[model samples]
Target: MSEHDKPGRIAPYPRPAGGWDAIKFSAASLRQEKVVLGNLKAFLKQNQPHGFDCPGCAWPERRHTNRLEFCENGVKAVAAEITSKLVTANFFARHTVTELMRQSDLELEQHGRLAVPLRYDPTSDTYRPIEWDQAFALIAEQLHALDSPNQASFYASGRTSNEAAYLFQLFARLYGTNNFPDCSNMCHEATSRGLPGTVGIGKGTVTLEDFELADAILIFGQNPGTNHPRMLGELRDAARRGATIVSINPLRERGLERFSSPQHAAEVLAGGSTELCSLFIRPSLGGDFALIKAMAKRVVELDDAACATGGERVLDVAFIETHTVGIDEFLADLRQESWSLLIEESGVPREEIERLTQLFVRARSVIATWGMGITQHRRSVPTIQLLSNLMMLRGQIGRPGAGLCPVRGHSNVQGNRTVGIEERPTAAFLDRLAAVYGFEPPREHGLDVVATIQAMLAGSVKVFFGLGGNFVMAAPDTPRTFEAMRRCALTVQVATKLNRSHLVHGQQALLLPTLGRSEIDLQEGIEQSVTVEDSMSMVHLSRGFKPPASDQLLSEVAIIARLAEAVVGNRLVDWRALATDNSLIRNHIAQVFEAFTDYNRRVAAPGGFHLGVASRDRVWKTASGKAQFVVHPLDLDTPIHRARRQYGDQAMVLMTTRSHDQYNTTIYALDDRYRGVYGQRDVVFANRRDIDRLGCRPGDRVDLSTIWDDGIERRLNGLLLVEYDIPLGCLAAYFPEANPLVPLDSVGDESNTPTAKSIPVRMLPHLD
Candidate 1:
């Protein structure tokens, strides 16, 4: 049985506490929303340029023209970071770790900003305030006592600045551990791992400038309205200019349907939202490979027909000859794919596939963009390769208005990977580091996020240090993750706010509060700026404006510096000097990484610089020295169910989703306004036919359990059913709430990302 099946476990669905009216009341409370425009403007100007990067999504800035670059969620993210509210020692003194664990994620966020360093005391069961020196000294003791560096894991968030990230990786290596488990492991690990094989670089090949010139755009498995709100503006402009924009996702997200940019005064006043997606393709969860293959097969047929009819060739013959390899194999696989199987798997008609292929064949330039939905799957890498292959067939790369764009969530997630947050370090990167930094970097591949958790569970990992992410709660299989964290000898979190992960205690846990991007970071009596790499691979400077919420709070850089000093000693590197002056940190970075050459001078300019994208110039960095096409054959075998011997029937597939009002792990409110979901987080969206087939109706409570090979069973008690326009035999529900049903072992084929988007489950009535 799954952990949730236990007697005392909390049910996945919680009854609506105050009802829809109460939720509406709470949402309406923001109508008279106190505008922080003045503060925002001043802060944007003073802090944005030189401050730490925003911890939100990695969508690029609009040329840094005006100060109003941030979005609503960005504001909340910033405010949450630079809030006046403080979580002092007194607050933690009153509540034990166990008590805090009982609080909802929203309540934990509402507890406000963490103000000082805290250490959990087992006797009192509360976190008592500890001095920074003491905290560092204690952490040092644990690190020193570790039998081997491999026993420790260093976890990082995408929010960390380039300088901090560089220092973090350096510290991990110098400390003798390459076990760097980071945020990338959970989200775009597939993109990082798979893209390099196809395109020389793991990052997106396109720049923001490419978006303006594209004739056609394909958005796959991403909702811009909620996750990356600012991107909606770009899509709206692109759609307005007559660009063909297609959206492919499991849900018919309203964001892809229409968007009224709050920035567009006339549009908002007229109650008009711009029409987005010219065509919306609803594919089955984890069915991207099937969909893309069907499209590819159609493209090949069109190419052959064109040649026979004295028409222009659909495929870019010259580009293919000069810049790519393995096309024949890929094309053969596509040609072999059966239309019936594609139709059944993709949940899209063959006609729709032809239409999409025709559009691709006709477009002069096309940009393919995708989000976590594509990356967080079993065939994530292969799916990405398929996208690259589709683009290459039309000679889309190495030109304006056409390329691949991976829409990352964190501000510097791409940057972190760029600067060396990876578990797998290249020999060239290590050689450069040794030549410049005077130390041989670890060559052995390190553990990723999943591997780290598994290591901890097996008693192989002892110390856990997170640079700035919520590890426990954000990871899949919460019960296992929490227990693994608890098994650690020590756990250290460098963060800006209180999260559930903070309460997932170790033998000794340290909560080291840090300054946010919106706050002034004073270093050595001089104002300093931190750099962040955006989704488009543009490296820009971010400076903060408001004074820090607490004087006790340290910058992320300072915390890392102190920790490094305590653990690695002053001989390896002067941590104090580097912390005192960010310039020193940049200089050190420049010495080790060739990409950051003259980092200080380049960032001093009005607009930050773009990291070199090799694909832009047709420099393929793959092993074959050409863009490679990978073939992924479709597998249609469904696992047989032993329980079905007693009652024969097909199991349903459920995709976990997020509400419009929520960000990853942080629920802003209960209402999912865009989808017409109100004050109800426990409702599951299903097709009316499916409900009837299951002997249920709308508003019926049902228990959903996963049908996995392992005898694990997860149930969501009292989940209200809502009839929706979803496909038959398919179900959708919000994540974290439904996360319990996803087994940690049920991960992506190559990426190791949990298949949260596609889980097979059996349902039962809520008899209790």
Candidate 2:
């Protein structure tokens, strides 16, 4: 059999990341999408000064230095958007919803772009084409028929433009509800909740320029090669400058070990990979809290030793005294933590933790970056705060090259929250919005993603509206979430392509096709531009020059405006006029938020402008007016650990991960090149010791079930085992497939984000 015919073959990738293979794969994506010649111009326009931003990742762009600013994944995203394949009315007529649900996510995406609006026909069990006006009117009728505004939920995805998100929030509030469930709640909500109490801001404090001046970079729970490939360029430059780099993750990811910049002709042609990290510390799943505390304890011990010897102080006492509070309490808690407990909880040796602390002491400037792996745990908020406490010892905040960086997943997830797509709107934000719009906005907190699911299942939330996402696939507890979706009275989705969400319908469902990021958005015979904010808080203009996929498709801004008009009839605001001019929406936004002063004029400048962060400027907005050092106990008596202790060798912590071939919920292919599994995504990665302990051999098929207290039985069968480099008692699997194992109620304490990285599961070998 040929290599492609193999189901679950294990072979290590020979070469390092980003060489000629990257270019070849990118070309393959273009050919598969049938955009080989048409996407050439899009490659030049992406991430440029006056061009559209990439729809793939949230990594900030640099000044216009190179002609090609897009990465391999960015090329794939653009090619998919500008593909010649179309899903017309005739295509939908060929298949029923029940039939479509059986296809794999990859096959569904391969069918291509949705051309027109459609509505579900229950009697026929098919989706039939519907006119835009009639669809909007029907949605309005269902929403109006609801008993209260709280009965309807509005969901926003991460890729939505700032203009569309602002309009969406405004409309939802005007209708008298704060029921906004956004995509950010799934990934980085821990950063949003943890940062504010300690650093007085919810966003990252570092800029793109800070990476160039750093003496050390510590990455935690992030694989930038597959998720944010462009970050490899920055790490490559930092490594070349003799900077010390360290990575703390359960798996030794290839992206952090070494990388070759695809943009650099010399490196690609010479086949040389730059060494990224000096130290790779492997911590068990959900162990970051204990790991960070261990590092802090060692730092305090070193400082005391230095003081006794009359050597230079290791800690920055002067800066800490002036800019921070609660140091005494933080240190006391650190001293109470035992060495044995720290080692056991973190799954790292004392020697390794001490080595990491010494590196931190020697580097003058450092940047601590983390991803969802650190956020999707029950103790995620406390873990982030502990990290902040460790950095405050050296007074790393408000410096040239030292601060916190929470790498966001989607290109515009942060932007959506910035534009008020939030369920728990602050009093100040509501006041300003009410003052600007001349109406009373909703004051009570509303349902988030988790709450929305529960409310829907209880039959309280009747109507559901989504703005660009596959909600069924992205949410946790796939079986339960699918049932909740079916309970909805009316469901509406605005997207560019078909997804699983459209197949899992409510009593009545409407699918509205919208323009993609790389397509022209003409409004009232004039072209318009929308803006997006990157992870580093750089807001820039995105203008699309290519023709749209279908003339029937509408811009997100236009769709929201017309729907609002149909529902509310434009009382105080002119919805029709705002739909034609995005500047008008910016004008309204500038009036509500002070940071957006002169939004239209400022964003028109090249490379856009930066939204100033208070913490970065040494201005704390906390109640104490100073940075606070929070204290968290070193404890690992969580649900997963308890289950492991009770079930003995049967329980293992499973973490859901993204494959190299996929973006969020969109699956591009079945291959995960980095971990070396091809033609299948059902394989599980486990340490060799764990494999032996579980009585499983290489390539053995097993049935996995969740070890939850809830009576619900969630099981996934026929998963092939692959012996790999992972921490003991931990197994790794791809997301959406493994999402079923994560219970809906198992979430972070304050953030309410699902613990996708800390699931307790039991393995049963298949009897074959």
Candidate 3:
């Protein structure tokens, strides 16, 4: 394990996004990954129309002809995926699981890609190489031996292809369980749960094309510079087009301040960058609801003032009447909202809200995009509703340049759910699956990620299988999730690299290495191209060109099919043929999903096809048959309100974020160049005022304890606190390191997504 034992270096970062730093860093990544220039050139075809999708983010490709579509983070992801480094059986022989567990999260993943199937040997505390057939057989035996199908839990990741995800869900349902715990359950479950009821679609209403025409774009609770670097390009472009870009977050993000696109040689050479955000608002953690509501109120006020003088109405009256429902009640609720409470909770001045209101009033087109910040709170569903309400008020949905965009994290996360990787399957979908596959599909609701954690803790779940992703690092309540995983009789991780999840194993664990997005999968001499849906509903084919890093590596589709064959034994489904030809899998997918009517033909086209969203067509599939305007009364939730009452007003609201060098759970580099922190993950970023208030100076060593309702007292000790530009009484730290502070039970109202973005913690200076 490559541990960052040395203290981190915090320095001043003078330049904006891009410039020489972008070029230098990307070059460093290629060098670190030991990629040959030829291989690197081939890998650079990522996200191309005829090439593979970058595993970094779900940001859609602009066009096939765009010289450089990938971003800095995308390059890092490609370098990591196509790295020359390998963690083979020989490497595993040198280290035990216990010994590996001692490595830091970043170090554990840097051990390199898993090259072969390896099973954990509990007696030796080491991983030994195993044959694929025997490994699948062991998993099948354990699963079959379970008292009930529900006793086994299956997890899918956002990285899984649409074909693989479809097959995985199909396998689970055929096996008589809906126990699908997926990455979506942790990230954007709020959007998945909140959007459909309102807009008839869970995905973003705006397309990549919309970015060009937007008058204003409001980004909330997300940092594009680190998490989704490609978005910074779009933001830069939008800003250059004179769009008013507004940023609402707990901490000021560099990407929002300004961006210099490395793709533009002139900008890099001249050190010139575009200022991205017109107005940057830092709301307190969990203050998004109040902020959104207040914005809505101001918009309505502006509309009323215009209507009073018999002037042009700010609200789209005709569109509202024809396409919306429950607006009257929603407006009433907004009108009655308390300004004092909203201002206090949101931590935004009334004048700032008024300024945004004026911008909204003036703008004819607006797109409100949000990320984990708005979704990882207790009131996420309501907060999303507030966003939807704001959009619909001005008839943003179905419009040319305005809509609701929930920036999805993974490359194909939205598509995974689109292709049926959900715990709660719709009866219509199940019926279609049963008819197509000639098997009785599971109708009962299954365990999501959090519920799966609880099930594992109860000792009911014996077999745990993950298609992709590092679950241990991704899940909240890290200690508890690890304990639950350990309770499983057998655990399986079908992945690209060795992460903390592989080391934190069950009684018996299997590390089944699989092909990454960058690697080609040929079955029966024919190369395969898998499809992935972007943040928008655009479904495109991703064809890998590079050979597999290891001959032993199998594609995720092959792995899932083989496992299903071993376990369920292809009575109704031809798992073998599906594995051999991906087209057959797509055909089967088309048969079940109406959106994929001509899936094969459409995907074969140049840029693939869009799954024409219903809301985009102004045909709502919702219960109302119109866009629904739902209102949530503004108030602090029980947990947060209680914590503030008990721990005083100074209690810091801790938010676990991705570093500049990370993409979700994968750490590409140790340095957070944008935040000016290098070679460490143990440091916490807090406000200067808060540090002074707590009687601490910059770089003071501290320990943070979660102020939980259950009083479990989850504590992360020996953390170095750095006073920085965050809201007072708010702290920012990178995740998996801070995952333990997020309680398992702390979830959103309807989404049930882990509240990883907001955890109430009290940090004290370490005397030692």
How many residue pairs clash (N, CA or C atoms closer than 3 angstroms) in each of the candidate models, in the order given? 10, 0, 0
- Residue range 2-88, candidate 1, lDDT tens digits: 232232222322221122322343233233233244454533553244444557889987555565565556655655664456789
Candidate 3 segments whose C-alpha is farther than 4 A from its true place: 1-7
Comparing 1 and 2 on TM-score, the stronger one: 2
Q: Report lDDT per candidate.
A: 0.80, 0.91, 0.87
User: Candidate 3: TM-score?
Assistant: 0.98
If candidate 3 were superposed on the true structure by all CA atoms, what would the RMSD be? 1.9
- Give the TM-score of each candidate: 0.93, 0.99, 0.98
- Per-candidate Cα RMSD to the true structure, in Å, reads 5.2, 1.1, 1.9
lDDT of 3 by residue, 426-489 (tens): 9999899888878888788999999999999999888899989999889999889999999999
lDDT of 3 at 176: 85
Relative to the unseen true structure, what is the C-alpha lDDT of residue 162 in candidate 1, on a scale of 0 to 100? 89
Query: TM-score of model 2 relative to the true fold?
Result: 0.99
Q: Tens digits of per-residue lDDT for model 2 on 1-768? A: 446337667788777888787887788789889984755899888999889999899999995546588888888888888889999999989999999999999999998899999999998889999999999999999999999999999999998999999999999999989999988889999999999989998999999999999999999999998999999889999999998999899988887887888888888889888999989999999888888999999988889889999988888898789999999998888888898999999999999999999999899999999999999999999999889889989988889999999999999999999989999999999999878878989899999999999999999999999999999899999999999999999999998888999999799999999999889988878889999999989999999979888999999999999999999888888999999999999999899999999999999998899989999898888989999999888655799888988898778899999988889998887888878888899988899998888777988998888999989999898999988899998999899899999999999999999999999998878765
Task: Tell me how candidate 1 scores on lDDT.
Answer: 0.80
- Per TM-score, the best of the predicted structures is 2
**Ranked by TM-score, top first:** 2, 3, 1
